[model samples]
Target chain A: MTEPSAKRGIAVEQAVVYGLLTALGLFAFVVALGYGLFLDEFRVGPGLVPAVVGGLITLIAGWELVATLRGQRTPHDKGLAEIVAAAAEAPPGGVSSDDDLPGGTLPSGEQAGEGTSDGVDIFGRTAAMRGRQLVIVFVALTVSVLLVPLLGFLGSFFLLSLFISAAVERRSWISATIVSFAAVAVIYLVFVVFLRVPLPAGLIGIGG
Target chain B: MLDNLVLGFSTALTPENLLWCFVGVLIGTVVGVLPGLGSTTGVAVLLPLTLSLEPVTGLIMLAGIYYGSQYGGTITSVLISTPGEASSVVTTLDGYQMARQGRAGAALAISAIGSFVAAIISLGLLVALAPPFARFALDFGPPEMLAVMILGLATIVSFAGDNRALGLLMALTGLLISTVGVEPGSGTSRFTFHSIYLLGGVPFVEVMIGLFAVGEVLYQIREGAAAPIRAGFRELLISKADLKRSAAPILRGSFLGFLFGILPGAGSTLASFMAYGIEKRVSKRGHEFGTGAIEGVAAPESANNAAANANFVPTLTLGIPGGATTAVLLGAFMINGIQPGPLLFDEQPALVWGLLASFFIGNVILLVLNLPLAPVFAQILRVPYGYMYPMILLTSLVGAYSISNSMYSVWVVLIFGIIGYFMKRLDLPMAPLVLGLVLGPLFEKALVQTSAIGDGNIGIVFTRPLALAVMALAIIQIVAPSLMARLLRRRNSSRARKADQAAEDKTEEHSHG
Candidate 1:
């Protein structure tokens, strides 16, 4: 009836989430307090504000956890079901409690009014795991960012473009080459040469 | 007055702005074709590329993206039932159905035509009426401004997912987040924590990229990918009848969009939502709304585009931003030593008029491009999940990094991406969260400034007639929908029970016979 591949829904899970937030808040408060210390002699220093913010975020996260554990449901949802519903967050249709269902989650490929006994897939632990696929793409992007200054905009753009088409878009080498080249040439011609917005070039950069 | 705007035809007609506008629309169209991405993010990502350009050209490009994306959003909504933004959520009802019924082509054509028609009408309205409207809005004091902000509050209930408080909580979080670096009024470092990066408050673009783009990527990765779809080109056009039926909805939505566009802070999403709601109430067969009505797509698509251009009024004339895109545009204006205000019309007549003129030109061009290229764009709907998942993640991070060039921003992008992922899983409305975060500072700025003027009088929200009226309206906007839904559910429930009983009797009679 509910999502808990690891375990059933429990207050401890909610408490743990909240407690971590509170700990974070406390850490922030300590950081802020440290900022007030001037060479070991404490006076009002710069950390006062950050301390407060971190403290607040922590507190809010904590309070939310506490509320969840107590079964005092929030105006927002936090459970696995809530996450799944929120993913696609569609309006309910044909279901008995469609209107009241907190519906935001990763859109499971369920057509409206279609659900299977296997499990409601709008969200599940599987979606959370699949999130790692995002990391590979980001890593490729970071490398591209560093390369832009090193190899020059056109050069870096070419390499990055190819990498992305192949790595991300999953195109064939020949296709990635054709598309990347075309895309870069267009960007270079329009943005760099035509429009005259200075793009990064390794040691030969302009646009100050 | 029309002539003055037409005077801008010379500057806008320059081959340069026209070309960029085309580019902008193309990029926007591409972005919109992708599911889980929308206009605001498109504008935000593109803004940096335009910083070095003349303000007007950059703004024209941004405007193109704004409306162009709405046109593109419909293509996906109809074909795949995915709404990249909340404004098009209603479109999925009829759009996907039409696709299923093999009328995908019709849905695409009608939505595009409807959007173009509405956009042109709105552009005409904007050119003819915006300046005078601005002059009137210039007179809005703190109370009146408060009223406008309060009116924005009304969106919370409609947007507030299952629990209104959650929306408020998110809004409060946004408010706090906005107040991160320096307390503008007090000049106190309220939350920076002595970090040099914190000296400047969180950048709106960075936050938007994190919340919308990155967050969406995380969610997409988790859900996995849709099965491969191979739609042939022949499957994408509408019959003449579809166009005829959608025409009235397009007109109604356009008018609604224009009116909403005229209002400060009431952005495209609200305009579309309202248009859809009205279409539902007035439809001869309102009961068919969810099951699949072309009216769903027609109404919202028209309204979003109409509201999109209309939103430019506050951004340009009053030096006030009505929504996220406008706020970014305001940044562009400030960067170029041009303050967008009443004086702007007098000082930079060419810039203003040219921008207005380009809107018309852009809409026409976009229509031409979309009508012919609908099938090509629809092909984007078929890209496999394995390819799409990794690509979405890549673009999101790169976009985030480009916004701020900082690891912390990247971290925030990841964090929010995760939050978005989890939020999607739980069924919490991300629209309200994004809206709140984007508008929170504006709301707070207005509230604080208004109260400051009232000199600690809490009743000023109601005591001031303008503020009072708007406040009351806001309250109703929030409370009314939920109440109506409750009443509707009751009616639906009772009706269903009665129908079931009648069916039971008929079954009994048939058996007896």
Candidate 2:
């Protein structure tokens, strides 16, 4: 990773920290005023302490902004220096994978850095496929919950087993169905018959 | 006592309660294994089902789940480093590090054994020390409670080392949020916003589920659920050296946990952190803290379990709830029409002893189950998040809605999830916040009652010997530990002290130099 120039890195860090301070300061100031105007107990209103605290935050933020702009750095607080140390001398500006970052992976392959593949459209396909996977899984879960009311425990679970295994579990059709059927049967017998917890009975009349 | 205990055993050893206990442990472990599920939500879901059974039976089930889940949680922390609950975060430091070194088996084995020893010691303390201990909690009337809470509030200043101001703000935010629905002094509702359900205020389970479980899901959703890190089953059990190293720390931690457990409002997590802190201070090895140390695992693990079990004393004896789980247990007591407090032994020896018997039964069951099942519980950490979160969202929706069957609550839970997510992202600890909220009303009520009893003077609190003792104990709880550490540093050999200089306060020292 190519390290960014010190000047450029410092400038970026200053902008980010100062920018956050300005935003938070403004938001807190406005909220404090609104609290005074609306909420009761204005003299010792719950908002009063919050407003004072918010004001202090804003002041420190403003102070930090000024110090950074002036380049009057404190001993313990080297915002830019810390960033440089962390980023280190690795391949600085390049994405390791187009589709992901370490903390949270992106849904699209274009994010992972392969736009140069002539007419490949890798990013769009990866993103679309990921999105489709989420939608299918969500639907399967929602269907299982909804079906619990109608198909009863046994039947609804059977269908749920099939859809989840087939769509999300990524298995052979027979294997998915078999696992689904068997698991649901176990849950059904344990919760319903053995425990005798009341369960919904469907048109199949399984509840007895 | 032995005959009564035997009789108690006879009562709890029945087929039905035993079966419920098994079911509870199984359900507890499942919920504990899942990231977005916890003992509180699990209890809330199953609490409704328990409404049909005898209160003792129901409580036995709930208690089983509460302790069982706590044990199950360490599995995740040690294996994948995805903490199953907030308290388990400390476990990850030593635990996952141990796992990475191919001693995962040792970590898992030692944790189960540590937890087992802690549970046994803690239960022994509860039975032996409960009555006289219950007498101590009674000393905390309003003024003393206020002072103690004030001190407890002061603890945030110390605990939130770097972010003191933000921590205080968050704490006050908790104290204030807890005061939202009702005016404890007056009959008037303060901030219900005209909703009937809001009058009940935010339920403890709802807030916990939102903050810990749902909050975490939001972070996971933001970061794709699949962690790149991996550790296999063979590496998951205990090594000989690991067991040898942890034995002493486990012994120390269990003792500490049981002592803290008797105190109202001091729960397992704090017990764990305190145990970790003490073990770090007192252990011959100091540098192994952030890096995986077996003592670190044993300390927190043992303390947390012992604390979890010890909390039962307050609920059983004083009728005053200690923590959230015990509060639920308190509800069970009230439902059973057997008021807790000193009268309990005289009025219903059978019921009380029987319940104690059940705890012993449950602890043994926990020991048996935790070792073999460590690998199984760890598997849930490996479950695809895509599969996990959807189910969490589904269960959360069902759990939140089912409480009052209210849609608005569902929305509130979601909104809190977003807020809770941001809190975690911003690096705020959620425990003290929850503890503040949970204890606030009780603190407020105690304060008012004491003031009234004293005819507005409040001097009666300190003037009373019992009250003074409790307040003194609370302060020592805060200061004594730190002072002892510094003293330990100062008195140790000069070379040792020089070696420990790195642990000294270094806030502006490096910067100035």
Candidate 3:
């Protein structure tokens, strides 16, 4: 009932996971070896637990590798398959430009599952936009963090929120701008004014 | 006991404590109603704010959040079929069906009432048992403590998921990471790699936020949004008949949950699942379980709440956290310079009694708040995921940064968030990892102390009768689940073979005729 290629693919993925785990275990073991297992006073030293833990990791990871090589399936393998399948079924190129248009009707929270019927190609879209979106979001957050020393907490947070709304959620320019500033104001009022946290003040340093 | 209760009530009744309790429950409910945000995340994110308050007040607020979130998770399960917490997953099997059948009101009301009843029952048990349990734990020395911790670890690893090996590996990884800081005994850093920031160790709170909150947001984004069902205020009330029908299951679930909750690593999620399974087997209307039976909604909801309350027994007595949220609470205890163990009951009787009294008050507040607000909270599901996720991200980032006011902590959160996403995709359990991280220092200290006490003898644990017994139990705990699974598999295979043989024989007879 199952294709050989699919089975081979799963085997390959399992091997990769096991191999990575084994590498991590070995690395931890090597690092732990730098410390003494037991001191001269016969008391357990800094590395005792780490050594034991690292050894156990290596043992378990090796077992997992052997099991996978023997054509056995693991829960990790099954979970990975599900993730891959879901990603393959998602809409291509993320949400389209038309959906991002100012007057476009946003789907209700209930219609979230009826994504396929919203007119997207099924094949060649298996590569999910999720990876791209995550990278984008991560980059935005990193930039915001870097900007905090220059722009201050309020300014950095505002810019971050605006980017998320406009670039990620693809909201209209006016709504994104309004929501971003409002959200920043609320955050500043609660975290700085009320909680009295000393948020960083950069160029537009208003509150400390 | 009477005097303790008086002291507890007087303390819990204060205006400041009461206000904080109310705030905690309110926030707990909101976060719990939002899918992908569980009590573990809620407690971790808010823990920093509590650092500024008195220890007793902070603890009361945390406890309120713990139980209130259980009640909140039921709302989403019944209304939208989306379980806001892992413990609520079983509730959705029937709760969502009830929503589809227009009995959403009855389901929601029963869940709330059941949760309230369970909380009171479990709180009674906690008060009655915790003191005695703490007294008993007073006899535990280094070796005994080590045995107990091993038993706890074994229980968690066995029950973590279908693959025991993966769970154990994750827990070991957590322990390894925990060893990165300066060793207390030797004063030498184990795996800091010469970094100054690493001397203080990996921040557990930041890891919790990253793993639970940020990781969940990423997973949700990938899954895409689903439409949540709408409910009106009229549908929030239940008939008397519904209450009558649910009473027995509620009581049964409470007892079962309390029993499970006392066990190390047997958390609310497991308790709820077990309660649902037992209800399906024992209830008169069991056959209709998955099709929106009121008893189904009542049982797991009650069980989870009871389990949440009962988790405090081990946490406050033996200093062993029952699950992830309790682990965070243990960290809170340490942050406030309060060590939770046998000594705690004697050292801080007022604090202990006050916390016990606040549980009752908090449950009452939750009942009054939830009964009228279930519909209101359900309306939160209608909020677009697009708007919600960015806020969640911001909260996680800020929560991590606020802990130590260090950008390094924020970076730790981001790194762990990616790791958590991969772990989820890989089907590795997170709770056991958290348990391992929290317990690592204690476990190592116990191990070292026991060795010194026994003059470096490795068999010191076997010399003590109680420690030996606990070690034996730990071994049994590790072996039992897998053994049972194998036995069940064999029986199922035999049954399948017999059925196939019978069908083959019937076909041959028909052909011959």
Candidate 4:
């Protein structure tokens, strides 16, 4: 009974994706057209390939959008039946759950539906947890990058690894600290000492 | 040839080269066993480190990593039902089932042994054929090169996944992305948007790290925890009957995989799939394919390894990469100012021969490393995601930063990581995209060169017999997959309709009775 709605949802999602891709293609096409098709002496200009590629992309994306609107399933949707069949044949207790299955959930977690604060549902909990972890990790990486100029490579790396492990992943602080330090030290030695990479050194600067 | 081989052995047998080979394979094995990271990511992440080393030694190490990961990929597939590499996807069908039935050791052992045997066979073929192939390719002009590139792209697009259009789209997108910097011939600014960083172009290695490593880490984290399987040392041994049963499949898979691998863009993943499919059709116990069939495990494992070695053929001889890992290796070659082509053998015999000889040594190292450590490697599954994912993120970030020592590259990694995540969600194949990005500049150059050579005549491509033949092949490749799929679907539907009609007739008879 819910199959139709699921199909519609996927179609809508695909349409949106294709629409965005078409827009990107159109933008690139316009920009590339401005760059001109030929330079001096009949030589092909920089814009030629990009323009053609952009045009192709626009055409393909438009076709995809129309297909989606016409209720055609994306290639991924067609593969789901195979996946389901394979999952069914999987050994007893081989899979932890359907949620853990590869390609099971949408990246946005929209397919899993909404999550409650209590987190009773396994799928909801997993989606919510994953979303939180992804954000945390992303932020951690961004902060680490920002910190590299101020704190130097080793200092920033140590802090980044520690924060991600201890705070984000929720590992024990002691172990995180140990692992972070060890990892940073090894990287420092390898890049700076042995390979002679001349990594950036900021406030606590020791010139390579 | 023999003298060159002796020289190769002399260079490869050096302590420095041997050590690097071991390190490369070791790192490859670890990354390969990890669920998210594959040989592509492994080679990309480690590439910057190799930049400081001698070109020959670095390449030998990189080559080791390339094939070593094939052996490592089997470990996860056999033990966990998770394929560590895309090529290992088929291995999970019967391998995980065998693991569930308490034969994890046997599965792991057979996979390692099969991979080793296939590696040896493929390596021998590579040595025998690569020089002649390169010599033949030396005759190829711009039109022929373009045709070959087109063929490669077509094969990848056709075989990428269920969606041919999506694959083509991704490949086109990659080509578009590659056009972001300065134009090669005209010295004109491209889609740089006036930024200095953009002027230099997007760093390929950073993009690779972001897409494969960071994107993969995010996916794994989202997957949460999976149930871990434990395999003891006792389970590592395969029975003599098991070996006898696997022997034919291994040999068949090796040859099939090698053939597929030598073709441009049809990589180890396709080779493994084809091997599994062929094995199912040919084996006596074919009906029991997805249910703990030893041949199922042996075929794909052996095939992937063979394909991994065979990939070097095109990469070295034609300067064309068969897959993503080889694309990175191609980048590595360029980074070292060593252009890989027909001229490479003549220009740098030591580097070429030494790298080949190292493959022989590296395969031996991998066989030794994988067999005894299969059970030990399985224990890596016991490591909590919490500990592992954070370290992966750290490595990715550091790897990205270290590449150019620029914060911009780090940002590139982060951005591409997100893009990769979304691409995965949308079920876009990443390989075609990477291939396009890597091959885009070369494709463009070939196109321009062909145009100039032909005096702007579009029909000149048809004039060259070799180019015409390749184009014909490309067209067939593009048409064949869909044609086969349609036929298969029609056959299945007709059979189902017949079954339904028979059931209805039976019901009518019962009602009359």
Best by TM-score: 4
Clashing pairs in 3: A88-A126, A109-B226, A109-B227, A110-B227
Give stretches of model 4 more than 4 Å off.
A1-17, A39-43, A66-72, A76-125, A204-208, B490-513
Could you arrange the candidates by DockQ from highest to lowest?
4, 3, 1, 2
* lDDT by candidate, in order shown: 0.63, 0.60, 0.77, 0.78
| Model 4 residue A206 CA deviation in Å | 7.8
Best by lDDT: 4
TM-score of 4: 0.89
Tell me the tens digit of each residue's lDDT in model 3 across A160-206. 88999998888998999998888777767666666666677777774
The DockQ scores of all candidates, in the order shown, are 0.14, 0.06, 0.17, 0.28
The lDDT ranking, best first, is 4, 3, 1, 2
| Model 4 residue A36 lDDT score | 80
| lDDT value, candidate 3, whole model | 0.77
Q: Show model 2 residue runs off by greater than 4 Å.
A: A1-208, B1-4, B35-49, B136-141, B145-171, B174-186, B199-202, B228-230, B233-245, B263-265, B280-296, B314-355, B405-412, B459-462, B472-513
TM-score of chain A of each: 0.52, 0.40, 0.62, 0.65
Please state the Cα-based DockQ of model 4 relative to the true two-chain complex.
0.28
What is the Å distance of residue A161 in model 4 from its true position? 1.7
Interface Cα root-mean-square deviation for all models: 8.9, 12.6, 11.8, 7.1
CA deviation > 4 Å runs, candidate 1: A6-63, A71-129, A135-208, B153-162, B233-243, B259-274, B285-293, B313-349, B385-462, B497-513
